[model samples]
Target: MRAVRFEGVGRIAVQELEKPAPGSGDLVVRVEASGICGTDRHILRGEFSSRPPVTLGHEFSGIVEAIGPGVTRFKVGHRVTGDPNIACGLCPSCRAGHVNLCESLEAIGVTRDGGLAEYVLVPEKQALSLPADLPPLYGAFCEPLACSIHGVDIAGLRPGMSAIVLGGGVIGMLVVQLARLAGATRTVMITRQAAKRQLAEQLGATASADPSAGDAVFDICGPGGLLSGGADVVFECAGVPDTVALAPKLARRGGAAVILGVLRPQDRVEIAPLELLLREVRLLTSFLNPFTHARAADLIATGAIDVAPLVTRQIGLEEAPGVISEPPPAGEIRAIVVP
Candidate 1:
């Protein structure tokens, strides 16, 4: 099998490797499509500290090539994607239904070989059957969509509420759509890129703002500002320190602030805890999706959110190494590696 592997920090290469046979209770998937995620970039830069020689594309979908002993729910040829977060089911977090926060967790593409290969091994229990009619590319998005959904759930969005999404990349755009579908009366999107703002409007954002043009996002979204004082919810999805720093001021009194991005180490963003207490503002963080992969698949299959707009490019496995080293063009989002 041909796989894209992280040779070391600042290095990645596509090489032929032995196709893994499913371990007991495991399943082997024939890779069809694997999307590159921002985490893949961190891993390459030594921020994620993944083991070397590990295959690193996690967002994906494919066919069940084989199943291990005792695997009964699916058979060979069944179309599937999987839960990439490997958790210890008996952990305190997992027992509390917060598997995303499990102390003992290993992720596909991070801690183990992932889908950027012709065939990859996954736990059978982690495999999810895709909607028969959904395209493979769309299936590849289930992971990220699920993560976005989890954030929405944490946001506690109410019907007729106003929301401000602080980014326009794939996750940010997805959050904008989810906010709309989740019943936000006004979902305003902000980004430095004009193209991203346009895409946001097309995806149902009630308004769009250019934060780079000397326009203050916090002031515009919050009290006594452009949109006339604060939104019901403000989602920090850009993963930028500056944007995360602006979150508290963008949310209304008693509103919720949801952090959806993985901030880099040494990046500091401060919030006034005393101010939050006075305003009754809620602060929350969504790490990853837990038990929501099925719902994301349903959303995509039913045309609830169009993912085609987010897929900026698709490359072969061999091109995966270079992409990790140097990202795509500005405003280009969600590049998939077709294995």
Candidate 2:
């Protein structure tokens, strides 16, 4: 089997490895598709915590090739999407139903061998069934959509509310459509890329803006602006200091701001605590997908969320290392690795 390994900081490559067999209560998935994520780049650069010498692909889906003893929910030949986050059931967070915040959380691709190979072992509980007839490549989006579902849940968006999504990448794009489905009457996407801005509008953003323009803030929130009083909820999806700092500023008074981006552990951002306090704005952060993977699978299988446009390019396992080594190409939303 060929696998893309994250050897260490600033090092990643494709290597031949033995195909995995299912352990007890596990399923061995013959990987169909895996999407390259920003976190993959962060892991390679040592900006995010990860276990090296491991296969590096967290957002992936495949067909069940084999099942181990005690596995009952799945069988060989089932198409499935793997939820990579594994939480210790005994942890305080898990007991409280906040499994995403488990004290002893382990992740596939980050801490264990993942689906960036010919075969990857998935615990039975972590695998969510996908429709057999659905396009295999689209199942790769379930993980990301699940994470975005968690963000939308945290935001508590309501009908007729306004939303501003910062960044036009996969997370940002998924959020745009989710916000509309959540009944957000007005949705705005802010990013530097003109192509992404156009795509966002097509994907249900009521409007779009280029943050690179100096007057974006005033243009969107100032008097006579598109969102004259700012949005009811703002989502920072770029995972950068600038967007983090700008999220709250784009929220209306008494509104909320949700940080869905993953920044480096050492990264810092400047924010105005007094302003947030005065306006009663809630600044919240959404982490991993806690219990939304199933909904993501349903959405993808039913064609409720448009993921076909989200896939910008497709490459083989041989091209995975090089693509992850470099920044995403201009106008690229996602690059799927077909192993």
What are the models' TM-scores?
0.95, 0.98
Residue 201 lDDT in model 2? 96
lDDT of each: 0.86, 0.94
lDDT of 1 by residue, 246-273 (tens): 7777778889889998777778887788
Clashes (N, CA, C under 3 Å) per candidate: 1, 0
How many Å off is the CA of 26 in candidate 2? 0.9
lDDT tens string, model 2, 1-339?
Answer: 999999999998899998887789999999999999999999999988898899999999999999999999988999999999999999889999999999899999999999899889999999999989999899999999999999999999999999999999999999999998999999999999999999999999999988878897558888998889889999999999999999999999999999999999888998879999999999999998999999999988998899999999999999999999999989999999999
> Which regions of candidate 1 are displaced past 4 Å?
216-219, 222-226
* Model 1 pairs in collision: 222-230
Candidate 1 has a TM-score of 0.95
